[model samples]
Target: MKDEKLLAILRLQKSKAIGDILAKKLIVNVGDVEQIFKEKSAILQNINGIGNHGLKHLFDEKNLKAAEQELNYIKNNNIKYSYFLEDDYPINLQNCIDSPILMFKDGNINFKNDKIISIVGTRNMSSYGRDFCTKIIEDLVQYNPIIVSGFAYGVDICAHKVAIKNNLQTIAVLAHGFEQIYPKVHKKYINQVNENGGFLTEFWSEEQPLRENFLKRNRIVAGISKATIIIESAEKGGSLVTADIANSYNRDVFAVPGRTTDIYSKGCNNLIKNNRATLLTSSEDIVKMLNWDIKESPKKAIQKQLFVDLNENEQKIYDLLSEKGQQLLDVISLECNIPIYQLSSILLQMEMKGITKPLPGKLFELM
Candidate 1:
């Protein structure tokens, strides 16, 4: 990319009022990101969602100076980045409406492997959570997935370490910038992590990890993968926030159930009870839910499963999916005369019965 283009992106990103969604709107409407800086403020304000508050920050001279400084830091440090409009941006993240318009990357990170999943949970993890985290990554090693996490304590670091042990790539998403690593104690693992996969962040070189930054970075952890797994979480934690973001993005979410009385288990159990996440027992659950083995199974397998017992609604959904090949969730609801609220449960039942499976973007078809 041209230096001027990069500078414009940095300037737009520096605008506190204009977030990713509105920034994308301005870029699309104006036909060029760089041109947004050149266009008259009155003309830019004419675009929908471009209010005075945002325009004030967009054209602020202080923001221009900050962008220039950050651009220099990026150049001096040889930092790598991805523009939302660029082809190199992660496809999964690109689909998220609120994903960062600009993101920084480092080390040996590669997007060639499409199998990516984010594992996150509480920092105060129990032995049970640790063992389960290790076992799942070991089992999934054969698939060579790129494990993603926040690189914090407990489940995040556990997932990263296990992935490296299995020789699988691992990505650590940072809430701060590359200039500093949080929890200075974990600094020892920095070299190993970089040699294994690398780091990613949307923050500038000197940004610190503030309380809200962790919440903000959760979306990237959720959006950059096929699914987000909560190994263990308390009643309230950042991992739960990541799970919510993943669900909002229409991606799969899985939670490991623990004993009801266990403090860390409350969140996972609630997610399962509320139907916000799938109850994960082992690696097979992840593989099956994400349809990782779909290619190995024969298409004829669908025909054999036709004899499986299904409820009236499940049968209706099965027949529709069987005939239509693959249909959107809304279309299935209409054709089967099932309300979306009711259809979601019916389809999940079919999935568990091995008669159907979900595809990305809420599409479904027979297994």
Candidate 2:
């Protein structure tokens, strides 16, 4: 974290045309972040993905001035940050190809042995989603997992609050800089969040929370956790984008299944229906799926019934799964001769009955 190297990183981050992917390429090709700025434009362009459009802004005098100002703010305010190459960078985010090269963090954030899970969903929270958030955090208290979220309204703030209530570390990944809080209303929770965990962002202090900034921040939220859970969402929302990003990173995704007619639940139901996420009924689904068996003495006891009654369609699906071990939704539909439209409803009911559970990649099996 030499002053000179930090400035170069800030300058590279200011480039509009050079994204995280291209920036990392330049860093790797040049062998150092500082070397990218010192190397001639012609030599830098020789690297793959470096082009005239990008190089134009790369060395722009305006960008240099902006970086200088940002650097001054970091130094004067004693702001904390993590470089992607450094050991302190989030371990989960390091594996992602498009993770930010640098991120500013605040609060008593600790990365010691802890399970991190991001719980995100719509800003318009319903009673069901709210209750689930509270219940899940309460259930997960035994694991001492760090709850990660957007720190926005609804499910985001709900997750953070429950984490704080349960005495668990919670990280709020902001879309804007640490200089300001978005939605303005959530400012009340800032101090509490810092006390429990902290705030994280890749944006510079002067940057505003724009539409695209949120989309970009979604990756960090998705990447910086062992799993991403969607409590509820509309047919479309930022949480779904986070789920997609987590899937791309080969991370586990869990979505709370809601009734088919619930408007806000459509996105989560679709995610589970399509097999992009597992059907999350309760904390046991997470414990079982993630194999969170650390510290044997402290493990939560999950009692599952030995068997549950299954009706005709449920029995058919159950019989097929019991026979085939685990089967894709499409394969089960085809093999069991159950039409997908009807089968979807049947499977959902079966899930509620604790007869079967959905898995990532559309697979289903007896629970």
Candidate 3:
């Protein structure tokens, strides 16, 4: 992106009152991010949700100075970033409604592989949690998933280390800016994480790791992946928050159930009991639930028996499955343009006809 355009985005991001959703609205309505600045107040005020209070911050002189300083730091450091609307932005996160408009990147992070999962848990991880975290990542090495974590103590660091040990890409989502590392002790693993995967954050260079920032950071951890795995969590902790955020995003969340008496297990058990997350026992659950075990083969023409009757929607679904191989329920619904409520019944009907079979994780495939 051009300096001017990036600067405009930074300025918008720095605006105190205008958040990502409203910023997006302003961008879409104005037709250009930079033009939002050049447009007259009267014209911008005409846009819905753009009131006087928002306008005051949108053009705040202090924001421009801050944005410029940040921009210069970005240029000087040769920092990498992804604009929410850009092609480089993570696709999974892009689908999230509250994802950051601009995310900074470090190290050699790669999003080419869509097989990404975030693993998080209590910082006071127990032996059971540690073993499960290691075993799960090691088992998942075959699929070479990108392991994402907060780069904090306990489960987060363990996930990163295990991913590194398995030669899998592991990304650390930071609560603070690039200038400082939280828990400062984790600095030793920084080089390894960078070489193996990288770090990601939405904060600027000088941002600190505030308490609220950690809460906000959980959303990124949840939003950036296809699924979230909670190896262990206390009855109340950040991992639970991440799981909630993941659930809100309609992403799959898996919690490893443990003995109810165990402090760390309480959160996972509650998540399972409350139906907030799937009960994960082993890596097999993840593989099956994510349909990772299903590999796409060469597509061939549909071969249905002539005697079998099919409706329009069923035919559309059959064709899609035949072309794309196994697909998630949501993807099928989207591609077939069928409502989820209707799609479920249609899929059941197809299943009864021995045309399609359901897989774990709401995936469906032709039998």
Question: What TM-score does prediction 2 earn?
Answer: 0.80
Which lDDT values do the candidates have, in the order given? 0.88, 0.86, 0.90
lDDT measured at residue 227 in model 1 versus the true structure, 0 to 100:
96
Number of colliding residue pairs in model 2: 0
Which candidate has the highest TM-score of all?
3
Worst 10 residues of 3 by lDDT: 298-307
- Model 2, residue 273: distance off in Å is 0.5
**Candidate 3 per-residue C-alpha lDDT over 290-340 given as tens digits, one digit per residue, 9 for 90 to 100:** 999998796665576642699999998998777556666655654566756
Error of 3 at 117 (Å): 0.2
RMSD of each: 9.9, 14.8, 7.1
Clashing pairs in 2: none
Which stretches of model 3 miss by more than 4 angstroms?
Answer: 298-367
Tens-digit lDDT track of model 1 for 225-251: 999999999999999999999999888
Q: What is the RMSD of candidate 2?
A: 14.8
Q: Give the TM-score of candidate 3.
A: 0.82
Compared with the true structure, what per-residue lDDT tens digits does model 2 show for residues 291-351? Answer: 8964457434223334455567777787777744556565566456575677888888988
